[model samples]
Target: MKHSLIFITISTFLATIILTHQTSSIKCFDHPNPLNFHQKIPVNCEFATRSLKTKRKSSNDKFQIKFTCGMDDKKLCDKVQKGFESAGQIITSTISIEIPITIDASFYDFCKTDNQCSIDNNVVAGGANPARTIALMDEDGVERYYPQALVKQLPFEHHPNFGPFDILAKFNSEADYWFEGDDSQIKPEQADFQLVVLHELVHGLGFYSSWNDFFDFVNPKGLTPIPSVEGEVKENMEMIFNGFIENIFDKYLVILSSGEHASNITTIINTIVNEKGKFYETPKDFIVKFKSSPQYLQSQIMLQTATTPFALGFLPKNANSPSEAIVLETTLNPYQTGSSLGHVDYKTYVNTSDFLMTYKQDSGLTLGDFMSIGGNYTGGPIGPRLRQVLKTLG
Candidate 1:
């Protein structure tokens, strides 16, 4: 009774660009291959769990963290574990989660071998994702994938196939990190390990997008669609996608120019699918027809909207107007897969209060430094906008 699940890992990177020039350019994009959704093989729910030796609960009893250190040094392992605990405590105190969430945290050298690390220039601080996801119906009567961590908070019946842990978090043990408890102690050249942990944990709680360019080769220029998971088999031996489906997070996304929801599959299909009620059966079939049809032009337009500055936004739940929408990271010219749609615009939020979710993080500056410049520092790295988003998602 194994079900195929799609997992997305959002990695935090220390940008190579200097702090002074961060607004103009930030090279924090993940390596293309690992970032591509199509390149990753689907994981089975049964085998997703990991065995960790140490376990600790947040002070508020809202989160239980199971941790393991792959690094050889015991002192370094203890520091990283403490960092994870500190991050979990921050999150537990901020949000009210009735069910205690369990996180599996691993501290390891991501680039120990030659091909282990993806990015050549920048150091990947860490990455995190939900251990599993369940396909459930949303308020609009549309079925969408919800992260296991979030699902536990909802009223839905507990999904039987879900793994023991809600979130799977991993950090780069080799990267230069400030492992001290105080944010003020973080050096300019070193990334704040606790801050990075907080950032990664949020991603695991479903701060990501499934609206990607997975089917780009079919219509290269303007191909950004939530690819149909039509062939995926579920644990009950049932097929998942009858048509295009989106993750729950995608429901909040809107095209700023047109004021249309990104999850409006009917409008998208009408625009790009040439024939009515005749969807392509497979990727190969879609490629043949798409290349020979005029529908690709529409796809190019879609891509344009995604890449254009201030074109895409996330409208909070029950918002008054589009003007209140939170701008997403769409300024990246050639749409860098992982860093583009899932993050806040780097240029817009670089030094602002919403800097936590931005695509690039500048090394050498502590969380306190960002709060000082941004003016309002309530607590942890979870900025105001990000906190609003997490609350809305739940």
Candidate 2:
């Protein structure tokens, strides 16, 4: 039940209505017409039990924006706890990376479960990673301590001041948000509660992937799918792995589709632990072993369109001219394992204006980067090629 990415950047606003949630009827994706939205703002309902926290700062910044509502309206949990304290003061005025963090959220009025994370417009409150995978190459490796990516140019090494707030998010108090209520901002026909709390706090701040803890460290029986026989799964199962990746987002994951950067994350987990072919014991879903290896899935879609080149920029489908090339859904769609293989395709940057890390936030584009696709928007708070792709991850 841990799969976060309904950002509505998983968004559509297409009102493909479907409701049902009580005793597990679960079927999200809602929208009727402000059955009730912002309802003329007036938060801090003063109800405090399950959750409610606040501690803002200024002169040198400080953070703490929490709120939890199971019921007892407190004005819809103080309008999404003051719209995540106004999206945590716009992510503390574009990052320098400070900790003592807490952006914890929860509302839940219904939409019980296709695995409980609401599912109407395909469940619109996903950003659930509690990412805690640290163990770069054991001197002992079993230690396990986590919390990285506060992004001051993070290459790796976290948990110092502690941020990545120990997970606690759940939304859908009957859908249709559109915060900043008494309206000063958040106006794009609403549904931008601080751009889905800055895209689920950027995967609870780690930009995600322990590759499902390396598929539960080589499928100790979890992601359930290894009955291969048809074409005998091979295109890079690299002979059914022994690569042992403990996840620092799999050391900057690379297949680079051979546009170069050859193969990363310890050379594709030691090229699937030194492949000798003729193998196949267990484990699956790296897109089912890269689609059973059709030339390593056309060299990993040619290294995800040669490293997300604005995903074939502004689609004439030329992805922005490498002599009219095109691939720009900005990589990682492989059937969405670990939240759309680490995000950014909100239908290929829906309408692009920084594209809140591409998944949904183009009410006409406000927060931006890709400087209209030439790329250069240091305005920060998550853009500029997703802050230069989370600074080449850990």
Candidate 3:
């Protein structure tokens, strides 16, 4: 009787435990639980350091940009805003599109001294919140300084840091040294400065990387607050080269006939030079002038790459100019004429806009008709296509 009672009690206790376990809820592996379900559940919660796709919310809300400057900062910041607005207007006009962000300008009157000017973070534009917006600074909330040594520390010495918001631009207030005579179209001294800003705006539009990886490596030491005399000289030299070949229509004479066409081409060239900086324009001109540079020739071809300069290598010589020489070699027919070699030469600048429109509108026309007069495309169709896009964008 005693044994039967003991056994019955034990069985009852075991049954109760089993029933409770069966009715309980499932728990994630990380959650604390009294039950042994943690081992049974398969949950993978690995953190990703870098994501391939950048996430953006479609709120239909607009962002406002305000410019802040010091008392004696000169008109550098104001002038920059004007140039940026010009580019923005062109983009809006050409595409009939408006960016989600709107621009506003104000000159800050905080930091003015004999040496350097300072900025007060306390007084921000109404729409701008230092806390809400990305600080664009280190953990201590201190702005990063651009000096010669700082920039040198970067992977690419003194290269620009293209950020979306609250970027600090340090440049000279004078434009006289940067521009000579009537060469004010591109304003060589400010080319890189403009390019960096443009690049940052592209970032704001989600054209580049989603995070830190989107940045091009530049030395922080080089960005420190130091006056750069050599930098100004370099910028001025670059403008001369960029201004030349961008209007190849002038000397070629074969294609350039109208004043309107010349004016438009000149404007487009100046725009590109301003955006890319004068450094890139020199090598670009070398290719077009000689009619043998692949990289230069490729710029005229329309191509697209969100991250890299793919179409730059397509041209034979320059980035935007069309080919100048076409070589033809033929073997003589024995019956018609004694064994002899025949050749013909043709030199002219081809208009990419005309070709791209034709290709988009008509398909039967061979690629040879648009690329070159003859149908000899040993290289793939990339160079031709990229030039088309470049022309359209311009």
Candidate 4:
């Protein structure tokens, strides 16, 4: 996701925003699309495998992967593809996956014209997400959405509708990226491609949060309404707002000040429904009372708290005390969408082993540089807290 914010008005909301899903064709990879805030698309149980070449893996490695590259230059494409392989190897070696994960990655010029690639351009470095998500009841009896890649590793019975590929990833080819395999000697002006790939791949594996400020106006708004599609084609697509829903990552969020779980507020907001057990008729109808209702006034505390520094935390499943909760990125003043609640605290993790998931990436530093500075260098970029979080997410 890009670090910049795009202010969207209600007049252009419907015309500009649309949900993300897997179709027969390939689309660009962008995360935190507001139209997909609470979308739940129908899933086809029948699995159809796509014809992509699988990457060669070590004999002792349990994790498997299939990679699809979308660039023309054979030399550059090979370098980018190898970077993905190296990143995938680190993840597989860190965590055990019974099923082979598929990734469709590309290096494209995000800035369409030559003039747009100026020094001041806010071009996206890379973006990735699960091709689809499945709704499943967790052990706590709450229904939460899980990424397709994570669901495949579980005992769940869901099937992929698109194909075997679980993640869709893309990178900006115009950006100054250090394509060499040796990440230790990266220059100060270039970003390490492998590090960026590793970070994006982790997001595809379920490191992102559904909680966002999509409905906020002057102050923060509550959780978004669950959305459903009404049209058969993209041009005529219509969205319907249903009940409230949260992702698996949101289940573990807590208020660091009060030691209160974030879901307590969502549980209250989820109860505001009509006689038919639905939220609202349309997105506009929901927005009308988004900040006016009494329930929303109460839940607004959690939403507003999301903008404070070191306020929100992620309490892992194996935490023995409240102090063990991992701090989330809530330091943004107005709560920037896609970068606020979706990442770790940049100030706290930037110089640590957990720097991979921070809000910003240092241009000059490599994985080795961070490891040397942070100490406790492991095999890959996945730090102790991050590894525990991903393992708990599964």
Candidate 5:
């Protein structure tokens, strides 16, 4: 099964890096030190708020990052704060934009006993941590209100001149993070804190897919993109909906074959569906035709129904590689959703010197030619193609 292959392949890949490392013994305190709540936002005061670094004036051109730490280990919080501050500086220096962006995020921890994590002050603890890899745009491929998480969690307010914080990441209180610099040798059991922070920050800055919208419910349960609306459609007579969206990582995507401009994930399905009204038995034979297919990426944003719905080449930065063509993950499985359609084509680029946005941080690779802008993220600057993609988004 596809699920089995994905897990086996990724585990085998990361095992090489993790198998050789060892964990250092650190003394454990009774409980994590609680963060001070003075000067914190009103919504959630469970964590204490601190301004790590306010590099630029509170203007539209600068970026502001507020670190809310809710952990017993003040030292770990300080290190994580420093890592984010470094990444924030790199983003600020990239271009002197007129509009400032403020990121309001919290880094907290939980107590893990045996194999389970105990709940922290925040509402939903243990089961899942609230490390939101957020996107400011509407995630639904359709009109609005795709995921319930977004509907209830819209920004309470946005600054006068600057936009709202695109990212709001929180961490588990008991998570083990490599606190030292990148050069520090990471044992098999230790995770590079800086590397993890850098990767999550990239996703927060719009390096993810809204492709999940296809499977998620549209405005309501009854409605579907059944007769998927490409441009505009009349739903139930009164409502006229325009399903085309122009933001998020998936929308700004450009296919390598120089075909039509794809604005959403429905173009391929819509094109093929229009022909056979169903999925092709053999998916391999459909790739070339899909690329050569006409300009129809704007038909429907939320894919209501599909026989075989899979993500396209949105994640593969090097789809144009002459060495070998990229193959996309078309089948959607619940277990593999995060690793599936949302990431780079790891199978194709794993062994090559291509993009580095796979499931696991292969932190084994390095790049030097492109760090002149701002000498930050020294150990792992954004990959060449990923950098290009980010620039294209702007």
Candidate 6:
């Protein structure tokens, strides 16, 4: 009965669709089919995953990204404390200077309670983290760490724009925690607590913008092969996620890419081309070139212009409402060809806000710098708040 109840809740949540546009009907908004060229191309997650995985294990000197601790151990905590202090008096008033780190699997086990916790979209997958609070600075000075589950049970949504914006980690499968401050899971040197703190601090601050993770239209069918151009476009998609853009994980970003059938790719691409500039616009069902013609890209530009004000908290409605946005250049179909099409879905939470911010400030910083800063520093207050609300639980 409990399992059935959980299934019902999950189904209802997945089936839920929130469209914020004032227009009565959903239209392409532009003509000439901006994504006509790449309509029927094959694409899949395994191909992209394989490519990314291969890149991770390659010997070639490609773009090698790594996370590093910002300050030396001696000043790490101090630097983080100071960052909190700069944000507001809340850091000193609520969180303490000295934090406690505890690891308990039992605490995480309790997070599965329906009333207490829900899956964290970020880590929901094979070997995923079980429910629990990985880290927390409570009202007292004590910073607590348990399995991921305990943290999942926290009552208040850290950000109001998104639902139950508590901090949690979704897992790929049943596995141990990723950051253990030990060499076994991750090298102690690689723990980068300062980096994590900065990232979370941004979540603590809140976000004022919205994002599209580009996972809605292209559902993975395992039959179609991801094209070479698709890989490059995917990287560009990431380019849009840098800096402050990553902070809005709490926003309900529509998955504009991904589909169970081949036509879904074209749908996503069309959306992409329709909403080119200004961020959060998509052509949904079109897959044209990144450097395609300007006229073809106008649809996207218009979509961006129309959506920008709402995403930036100037929508003339609820300032705390989750703004609408479209995902482009990625796939979300998570089923095999023989599997039911209904089971496949396109959508993912904003993993990080740096991509969007970096895109906004491309002229000022290198891509690597943008990523590094995104991983290391928390964005402004509003971005993190939005991130908490939009984040997905697998």
lDDT (Cα, tens digit) per residue for candidate 3, span 298-329: 22321111111111111212323433311111
lDDT of 5 by residue, 1-394 (tens): 0011111111111111111111111100010111110111112112122223422355433656777887677777788788667666655565233334556656654343233343341121111111222213333433221111121123323311112343455454454445545455544444445545555555545444434322222221111122212211122222111222233445544343442234434444444555633333222233233334452333232222211233345533434442222333334333242344334565554443333445444332222221332243443465445555555444
- What candidate 4 gets wrong by more than 4 Å, as runs, is 1-72, 112-119, 157-162, 182-184, 216-241, 274-282
Candidate 3 or 1, higher lDDT: 1
Model 3 residue runs over 4 Å out of place are 1-64, 71-74, 96-99, 103-196, 210-394
**CA displacement after TM-score superposition, residue 378 of candidate 5 (Å):** 8.9
Show model 2 residue runs off by greater than 4 Å: 1-179, 185-193, 205-328, 331-341, 346-394
Global local distance difference test of model 5: 0.36
Query: What does candidate 2's lDDT look like per residue over 1-394, in tens digits?
Result: 2222344312122211011111111111111111111011111111122211222234343446556678776776787777667665665565544333554566766555333444334445444333222222323342122332332223333212223343345566655555555455534433555667666666555554332222222222121111112222343342232233333433333332332222233344335325534345432344355445433443344334433534322112112323222223445433333333345555545444446655444442333322344254457446555554444342
Residue by residue across 1-394, what tens digits does model 6's lDDT show? 0010011101111100111111211111110111111122121211111122222332222211112222345453343333223322322232322112111111122234212333442221111111111223334332222222223223432411111212222111121222212344332222222223223332222211212222222332112111112112222242221111111111223322211222222234334325653232231212333325343343343234223222111111123222333232123223211111111111222234324311112122322343454464354322443333323210
After superposing candidate 5, which stretches have Cα over 4 Å from the reference? 1-61, 93-97, 110-164, 182-184, 213-246, 254-311, 314-335, 348-356, 362-380
Model 1 deviation from the true structure expressed as Cα RMSD, one decimal place: 10.6
The C-alpha lDDT values of all candidates are 0.63, 0.39, 0.23, 0.63, 0.36, 0.23
**TM-score winner:** 4
Ranking 3 against 5 by TM-score, winner: 5
Mind giving the per-residue lDDT tens digits that candidate 1 earns over 169-275?
A: 77776677877664456655677777677777887788887655544433336544444433432333322223445677888888887678877743454454335
Cα-lDDT of candidate 2: 0.39
**28 in model 3: Cα distance from truth in Å?**
25
Can you rank all candidates by lDDT, best first? 4, 1, 2, 5, 6, 3
Answer with 2 or 6, whichever has the higher lDDT: 2
RMSD per prediction, one decimal? 10.6, 21.0, 31.3, 6.0, 15.1, 21.7
In model 3, the worst 10-residue window by lDDT is 1-10
Candidate 6: regions farther than 4 A off: 1-201, 213-299, 302-394
TM-score of 4: 0.79
Cα error of candidate 3 at position 41, Å: 33
For candidate 4, lDDT tens digit of each residue in 47-100? 434323332344454434455555577887788888888888888888877666
Q: How close is candidate 5 to the true structure, as a TM-score?
A: 0.49
